[model samples]
Target: MKNVTRRSALGMVVAAGGATFLAACGAQPQATSGNASESASGSASASASVSKSVRSDYSGVAVLEGYTSKPSDYQPATRTEPSKNAPVPVKPAVANENSVEGLYQSIAFFGAAMEYYMRTGKTEPLRESALDNSELKSILEPEKGTLGDGMQQGKIWMQDPSVTITMLSAQPERDGDAYNWDIRLTTDTGEFIASKDRVEEASSDDDRKTEVERTLHGVYENGAWKLTGMRTSSSSSSSASASASDS
Candidate 1:
């Protein structure tokens, strides 16, 4: 099967954030410098609201940057075709609980939850998964301690996607062993698949980076997309910890 790497998956998430931000801004009144000053004062008056906005822990893969105002430079250049050797799609006896969009949205939340854990050294109640029992247990396990001191201080921006993800591949069944499955996604940023290999980089022999890929099966649960598997690359674990330190 065709594999799209991690960088591309992250890029897709960033693109989606960007699009959401733009739509929000477009719906609001444009602010001038004078308005900015006034807004600052008004914001302080509602410090409670501002404090609530400060989310240190997030549920899914944490993207440190917030959504960007400008468009992203990265774009998808290719498309993926299903393998002829692959098994045919199966219609499960149960109806799907999560839409494709809902699945992506839950992924974003999962990212946020990881961030929260790193920041507070506390583990929140993870959303239960319908796909993999073992994977779900791993995600829900309580932490012995904080991942590090606390979250790093910085504003993470998510860039808007140049395209939208129109299709996602069928969910792969979870066996006792871990396997890589590339899911095709179309985004405004470009077309890409969620692949672990795409974001890996080779380092010196003595300091090779390990990559961990978590799988989250989207299940229709609790009226939303619940992640069934949680994969974390060795590279991603380091990056996530580092992001907390840097923030």
Candidate 2:
């Protein structure tokens, strides 16, 4: 009788132990699964939040979209003037004769001229240069001419001096078939003003970039340099035109 009682007690204890072990095994799997689900959900939520933040921060400007990097192409070659009151260096007379640098400077100034027009919505007076007369006549004309009519209606701000123009090399050679340029512009004034970046490709292609190069016909008008006409480069046309109109 004593032996049977001991055996029965041992059997009861073993059964209870087995039940506890089974319960622990079941609970562990469920808890682990729940934890993994929560972790994944948290990660997904974080990703969504980041995406929303990026979308919200972007301004609805056309120029900001295509700009992948900052402009660091041209370092200051030389400082012509140290004082603000001093006259800036003028393009050399000998260097101005059908030189690539002359063209580059002309194109750069044309951008500034367009900015000036955008602000006033009237034809700015031309500076004297050796540009083609016919080209000057075309943009100066009031009706169909580009510089005359305001392209868009809005307040526009001029870009700061931080704006840089870089000429890119298409071919490996120094004198390649065609050239490319990237213009970076910035403004930190107020909400009415925003930053912009423009990249223009001036190839022989019939594309808009090419049109910009063709249309940028200039002449040396008065004693100062002036742009007679400009064809908007593909990269900067919309932004430049809009900014000019706004100004």
Candidate 3:
């Protein structure tokens, strides 16, 4: 996986944005709509449907659907933050789920949930959905810990980090013991908003955008598939740049 640090907001824009946002506070999304990028308006606010905006019960694994918000309605608190527009992440029914689509569901939902986790300061969303592994865990600690801590402390919240994760294949390529799928991620580093009225935008200063290509690796553990690694094939953002062979 590309370096997933707080420094490169563009690497996380899909997780950042995949949102419902006012076109003014951030760049407008050009991603095609699908289950991967579906969003509702003002989902974080009191206007969203109860079934759609409810918090996670820490039970099932499902995708976190996104909600839209305008810049004028942005708030310093979690109550009406646009990040709230993204509902809790949940996975699909894992029973007898041993197909490529099942893994796609897991990857998509996990990434979406992480976006919500890093943005909302909620831990359970990522907790219940992620399957742990020593190597992947260590590599993601910086992102998991840094963003997780910041959101929990209310120190930082990505304003419109737009992230889009796409599964490139309907099948997997086996490389010895691992199952790998070619995936691509595109991000827009939205304005970074801090609780004390601090705000910064990484990509806001430039027009250049980059697409990252990564190989999503997994292993069938026990009776289920677990995400084991993300190796970068290509990285566009400086923060995400690293060795091609490194995960």
- Strongest candidate by TM-score: 3
- Clashes (backbone N, CA, C under 3 Å), per candidate, total 47, 15, 17
TM-score of each: 0.29, 0.27, 0.56
- Which whole-number lDDT from 0 to 100 does residue 62 have in model 1? 22
Candidate 3's residue-wise lDDT over 1-247, tens digit each?
2223333334333222211111111111111123322222232222422123123232232233332322343332332243544444444443113444445555665566545554555555445433344423322333323433345554556555444566665456777766687666554445444434444434444432335656667654444456644433254443342212212
Provide the lowest-lDDT 10-residue window in model 2: 21-30
lDDT (0-100) at residue 238 of candidate 3? 30
Least accurate 10 contiguous residues by lDDT in model 3: 22-31
- Over 130-180, each residue of candidate 2 has an lDDT whose tens digit, in order, gives 333444443344332111221112111212111122323211112232223
> CA lDDT of each candidate?
0.25, 0.23, 0.41
Better of 1 and 2 by lDDT: 1
- Write down the lDDT that model 1 would get: 0.25
**All predictions: root-mean-square deviation over Cα?**
19.1, 35.0, 12.9
In model 2, the Cα lDDT at residue 203 comes to: 27
Reference-based TM-score, model 1? 0.29
lDDT of 1 by residue, 162-203 (tens): 222221223333334322223222222122221122322222
